[model samples]
Target: MLQHLKDHSNHEALQLQLFASTGEGITLYELESGKETFPFYLTKGTYYIRIFSNDQPMKYSFTSSFSKGDNFENELNNTKSTAKLMIPNTTFTGTLNDGGYDNQFADVDVYKFEL
Candidate 1:
């Protein structure tokens, strides 16, 4: 999954950390600047996000799901109370063409071949 963070706050430096929930506690996944993007390979589960400024953590913690190929964008506004995180839905559409094979078996419309 790809996680992107944008810091719109007036603070010049912000500390952002990504944590994964475990059976015992939370595991630290990645720590980066608020203006940078983080990429992680995680299993299907939930995670905790924390953003800090001047060594003080934000009031509200963000939680999100981490599935395969998921992308997330988090924005930290200047007000500090109006932070937003966006999870976009990704959809794929395509057309399948069966090479005009009339002798195809039932329920077998697609065939795989190595070129």
Candidate 2:
């Protein structure tokens, strides 16, 4: 299961996309507004997750695989400028620049881990 939270109540809704590892370039699931994806069985392989806010210019991506008993959690702020991904025994925090094309802030940050 995947879960998310925002700092503000009136923030733009969040978007999520899931992809398989078959390299077929197809999306497995797409969701919005913090809704949880329905429980589905998955094979043992790599999977991709993409997250972003409806009105923000930044996007975040992650990769994971199915395990015996694993839980995942993701947290983001309303501005879509900060995020945290948590898994068993590991946590990754990311921050992005609000400047879309102006380069006012540094580029977005991404962290990858294997479990």
Candidate 3:
């Protein structure tokens, strides 16, 4: 049977809470390895996450953060290779700099801590 909710789900909130585990590590929901849905938690404030990868077959590292201001880059990497991120509290505009470009394409995965 299916369950019903009291109100429509928040799209942005749901995205922030998504995660994927790849045995080695965890990653965002959209980047998960397998076709299974993983669970994560989300709060009404700032959050940070880091992604690590194996080097034997590949090499890369990923670190990303989300907050409620224009200083998004301050919480993340200061390099060229980066990923697209949305600042959680201020209208969801702008991109965050996630360190390590190669990491994004590696076999690395992601996990959520506090959700």
Candidate 4:
């Protein structure tokens, strides 16, 4: 597919990553300021997203076509032991940062709900 990439940061380099609940990860896309962007796919079942930006003060907007995301996620919930407790139907949002200097990137974040 062919599409124009949006440059909210003067074409600063950017990356959009995808991770499956099973911990499967594959680089789906990189949308730079002035290039064409190809759409990526996400097969069903709990997914995680990580956005990396070369732009220091990166600014972007994300909207889901379907109501499948929460509005808040607590940080450091990157492991099973650190899993964040989730309340049913409540909105939660979180950010996954770049594997800066140490490359100690938290590849996945999990949330749990107790019955």
Candidate 5:
């Protein structure tokens, strides 16, 4: 599963959008700011997503039955535990997992937005 966050300090309504590689592409989960959990179907491939908002210190998390890729060969490098991928003008905290496999990995995150 893939997770994304916005700048928590922005004080704006943020939308979390995610796509599963095995099931859908548009968005498997969509939620407003401060939502704890969002359920979505996961495919057996790479996935993509897009997050919108302008808040700093945002947080996110996800769960799926997919697997991680060889890229995570280094256990320490892999963010198995809850990770907070901080973005410019934003702070993000979330949990990402591959469900214990080596065939799926969601979008780690490209460019965070500020709107």
Candidate 6:
């Protein structure tokens, strides 16, 4: 299960908290080899995810499959005004600290797509 989860780029979060899932279990995961995953045993229903941290910056990505994708490019995109344009149905990788980190503020990445 762990191996399957890590393979999906979409299965990631930083110190994540999952709740109100369709089951009786919520697993905690941290970044390992650029991926994070949880137990994938549950019914299809409403789910809640909450991410909070005082020390570590949040980093996350998602992909439908583990087979193909492109690595995220770092371009100082910290706001909506400077959001990186993305291609539809394409996958990319990135991290919070990739931009830069400051104890006073966490790094933020912004992306946008056309209609």
Where model 6 places Cα greater than 4 Å from the true spot, the runs are 1-71, 98-101
Candidate 3 local distance difference test against the native: 0.29
Task: Kindly list the per-residue Cα lDDT of model 5 for residues 1-115, writing each as its tens digit.
Answer: 4345544443655455555565443332334544455443342456665555556555666554644332221212244353323346543333344332343464343322335
The per-model lDDT (C-alpha) reads: 0.36, 0.43, 0.29, 0.57, 0.43, 0.48
lDDT, candidate 3, 37-83, per-residue tens: 33323324444444322212322223334344443222122333333
- In model 1, the runs with Cα more than 4 Å from the true position are 1-12, 23-34, 55-115
lDDT tens digits, residue span 1-112, model 4: 2223355645666666667687756444566654453333333458777777766666555544543444455445678889878888786655454453234464566898
RMSD of 4: 11.8
Give TM-scores for every candidate, taking all chains together and pairing residue i with residue i: 0.30, 0.33, 0.19, 0.40, 0.30, 0.34
In the range 1-114, model 6's lDDT, one tens digit per residue, is 122223434443345444555543243344443554443322345666554433344444543223233445454678889987898877766654321123323556799888
Cα deviation at 92, candidate 3, in Å, is: 27
Clashing pairs in 2: none
| Residue 67, model 6: Cα distance from true site in angstroms | 16
* C-alpha RMSD values across all candidates: 19.6, 16.9, 17.4, 11.8, 16.0, 16.3
Best by lDDT: 4
Model 5: worst 10 consecutive residues (lDDT sum): 68-77
Taking all chains together, the TM-score of candidate 1 against the true structure is 0.30
Error of 1 at 33 (Å): 7.5
| Root-mean-square deviation of Cα positions for candidate 2 versus the true structure, in angstroms | 16.9
lDDT for 41 (candidate 5):
36
Of 4 and 6, the candidate ahead on lDDT is: 4
Query: Which model, 2 or 6, shows the larger lDDT?
Result: 6
Cα distance off (Å), candidate 3, residue 47: 0.7
Clashes of 1: 0
TM-score of 2: 0.33
